[model samples]
Target: MTRRTLMAAGSMGLALVAAPRALARRADSHRERVEDLIARMTLQEKAGQLTLFNDPFRWRPGNVNPGDFDTDQEKTAQQIRDGHVGALFNGIGAEQARYAQRLALEESRLGIPMLFAADIIHGLRTTFPVPLGEAASWDLDLAERTARAAAAEGGASGIHQTYAPMVDVARDQRWGRVVEGAGEDVLLNKLFAAARTRGFQGDDLADPLSLLATPKHFAAYGAAEAGLDYNTTDMSEQTLRGVHLPPFQSAFEAGALCTMSAFNDLNGVPTSGNHWLLTEVLRDEWGFTGFVVSDYTSERELIAHGFAEDDRDAARIALTAGVDMSMQSGIYLAHIPDLVESGDVAMEVLDRAVRRVLMTKAALGLFDNPYRGADPEVERRVVGSPAHRDLAREAGRKSVVLLKNENKLLPLPKAGKRIALIGPFGADRSNVFGPWSIFADREMGVTFEEGFRAALTDASLLTVVKGSDVEAPLDGGIEAAVAAARDADVVVLAVGESHNMSAEAQSRVNIVLPAPQQALAEAVAAVGKPVVVLLKTGRALELSGAVKDAGAIMVTWFLGSEEGAAAADVIFGDHAPIGRLPISFSHYSGQQPYYYSRKATGRPELPEESEYKARFRETSNTALYPFGHGLGYAPVSYGEIVLGSETLPWDGELTASVSVTNTGDRPVDEVVQLYVRDRVASLTQPERLLKAFQRVTLAPGETVEAAFTLTRQDLLFIGRDMAPTVEPGWFDLWLAPNAQGGPHTQFRLVR
Candidate 1:
């Protein structure tokens, strides 16, 4: 039925929610009892419960199924009729989901309900800031709220499960899809992952507004070789569990429903087919019982990893290794039965997998009410709704990173200003949309022109110049752009990679801008006018050349549809930009994975290194813009920290506070970070580890004390034997915005 017809029909979910106390309890109470029904089902029926095939009706193919399935339409339909297919993916719109539900309930022998899952990563219909961009906000509460908004919108659009809050700690800029994760900060990753999971799976699972949270690519896929997407990840075991594993652990603790395995191999083993990662680590130790689902045909891709010989072998290995769901990769359809009959895979294993899947559906209130998501009216009213867009705009505002403001060049004056907005990235809607945005309304994206238009009530004096192409050089357009830049009072050049430049499979050799584009930027800077460079892309680009002598610089990843307005607002003093860096920006591309926290290499590189030291010839190990680096319209001066407890036992606690003062003419936000360094511990240890952080807003010249409390667990690390423990020794504490800064105090540790 159409949205209008459904709304007019009216006797739907609201009816159940608004019913009388006794009758409402009786009808809706059945949702909580869905688990009992699944418990009584036979093994064959239980396997059917976990089997979610694609519903070709409304959820049309974005691409063909992962190689294991028969790509032909007739074969796919026949499988659904075979009564083995359970849930489906990418089916949007209520009518389509309802139709799929009808097929499962009416066509299948068991009349089971199909669980609908989709990649509602950031925003479902109304696109929000990319996860990495959102990480710049460093607001866990906001992250959770954004997840709720996404879940509501996705659920309203007939999406039951959202593959979201991709909590990978991305350090490499070459991986284009690192846009989906928080970059290289364990504390940042944990906070956002926990927030998103809680938001996706809200207080009540039975609420139709909630969707199951699938925090994914279950391991350190972000550290892929040379930062290449879908490439093998090799890291020390200590780095893996301590740095990369925290986000997954936090997401799991927040009650995530499912976890999707990564595309890359762990060590030499493909994650989808690795029993140790799935069973020994995730389930047995970490206690992740919700379920493990393979990424889009990841099992079939194991052959490409050189671990499996064929699709069948890949399926056998993955399923036996603890993968419960075969997403898009149709390997199970062709081979699971044979493997079961051959006694290579036990029926009990299948039963346990099916049990987990059914448990999730039951938790979602899907089994009792097959028509859970069939509300066409709610979909129309709430799809791309105003409230959701406003949230997107809020997140956009928070995602902006104001990097440099020479002599306070920012908070650009709105009145009496000849504003020249130059560069190819300023007007492109697609680049701002970021990747994995399946449903992002590119047409609706607000461009920099829109931002400028909205900020300048009367846009009579604003000049525009497409200075250079993002993917290529603007060989012919530079002359006109230079003239405009020279004529204007201030120039804002928006430049970065094109829309498809920095995501999955989008890794680069240099991790720098195209040489021609760099030359174009130099020609513009030659105009000798104050230039403000605003970067728009997924990963960090080496900006030493562009930044060589720019008046001001702003680092903004694809800032969603509302970013234009937010950027303009910050530029013109309506809002002081407070966003910080989520990933480290290196001085050059060679110092990649150049995070603030890392084990000091035995041969550490310095300006003048000793013969016994490890160092680099081409470059230094310093990043261009350090993590937690962002400039506001105002500057905040930090003072010395005071610690309450200087010596503490293993189980003792300590309280610390650092005073900060906004010593500028405008309001701003400051992020105070607390870190601890083990004076002497294992042979391999990072110089320091981030323990706590806080973001406090201050008015012009205002001051505040940021406080942090620490427990012994905060000092613990995964030992050489892989045991989480705290070593007894002296420790140094550093309280700073960036890692390049020195420590606040040195304290002794009691045994």
Candidate 2:
């Protein structure tokens, strides 16, 4: 097993170019050039192509690195020059990126171009709402637009790839990374995954404004036990296929060129070393041609998982198991070359990994011009540009979920009113970008006070008070808040978890309003004035006390750079709150691992009979705010669930329609959700599974019929045999607002 073996294997695709104009006509195809380059590479160079290193001095908080390690800049530079580092993360600016890339292309032996990657989860310079918040918008187009804006900023900054659109279906609120993904619905996860993927890569990877989207963490990282990060995940094959794997499949289908393996093990096998996941499912079944990169040091962590003997074993297990690239660990660089030569790892494996890297760089148009968009001027012009910020503001506006607006307390008057804005987040400039926004400048973000002042007319008066810290009470803060509430005609209480509280390694045992904030809320509510609770949070929190009883409540999940502006837009009635709960909000932390889709049990709790019927004595089993739950300024009503036919042929489709009318004076945008339940099947099915949804707008007193056509594919589920199959059976359907309850109908799937 050697370079000769690779060259011989790919000889048919290679064409020789003479020296006369070798530079101009070196190759006609990427395959030819990549194969030729592989042929000329040493084992170390091939291993280097599989290694991804971090920028030592440029590391920032919130960046994804599993372990703390020391680095020497000069040593790393020499490694890049010696072809021992293939890619770099931490996202150096355009100027620095150009310098490092020049070192690799001009100084390295093979002159291979290196890739630059960052975790652009939501946005780059112009930060947008976190992915979980954005999912609440239920606007695929907006999701795509935000991702496009992120790609534009990142590409201009010389970032060739982004580890983003975390498609994992996060079900547990305690999982800090839950804020990084779309909620528990498989359909929404798939839709958003596809949308963000397309947005990141656009239609052409060669486009300078496009970025390579890496959908991760591959396969059930979200299902970690106890909602803990990097914890073991064990599940039945059916659950794995049915619940966790579809979004990754959707992202790959949407043209994601790269993927990162999860840190956690799946059913006892680490994903970074899971042959069944990376090879059998991803490559052989789904036909994902992109290379698989291990999550930061995940390859090395295999040893800690007891799945490998040492670093060498970790390298062998991961690479042979189909992990193409190793991030940060340097385990691949340390052991891959030796493993390849020792007959422990095949030469074809090494060549395949190197080839994938080369092909990706080729797709990014790096070989044609390694300095793709590596211009300081371009970076300055595109990063945090006015257009990108406007898109962010629009995204922020859409991400707001009006959880409780009793008696229509929201859409407050914008003129001739005294308003009081209180709480820690009121005028705070920091923590607005949420997690994974390492590049955002906090100073540029808009605060709640700023937004309120800007939104108010000249005749209106605005007062601000920092009622309390996030987790502790401020001295006389509650009194000041109460005083401000008494003085103003309306009160806006802003509070919740800071950016750090809901991000990686920041999981909490209990998700509730801090005691001090709750006290502040209570004090403000006691003032007996109209109150609006601006809930700035990431995950679905367990609500209690005054915060829960506030007249109006909005989940404004850390709306990025324009957080203030967007909040103001919704608060002042310039824009309606359009976000719905992507994940369900439980009444208590005791209800762990909650989701809308659940299988029926023999001892199910009945609505009327709660005694000894698998019911909790202290609380109901339903979510406080169910999935897809949200309210707008205007009132909307659903007419009825209408089906075109009582029966659906196995090979044909069925149509379901619901007439939605805006009854209130203002316009209403409604998300018409279509859910289906297989009444009887070989394997137990969820009570209801979301199959389709549409967002429609209706003017005052206007009605619109929202229709969804379902094919056999929509009914297909993993059956007893562990294969996707649609069984002939009666199915219950719901045309609803949310997952809990809606207008229902039934249809038989006739075989």
Best candidate according to lDDT:
2
Worst 10 residues of 1 by lDDT: 10-19
* Candidate 2 lDDT for residue 67: 61
What is the Å distance of residue 231 in model 2 from its true position?
A: 0.9
> Model 2: residues >4 Å from true position, as ranges?
1-28, 56-71
For model 2, name the residue pairs that clash: none
RMSD of each: 7.5, 7.0
**What lDDT would candidate 1 get against the real structure?**
0.76
Candidate 1: stretches off by over 4 Å = 1-54, 59-77, 605-612
TM-score of each: 0.92, 0.95
Which candidate tops TM-score?
2
TM-score for predicted model 2 compared with the true structure: 0.95
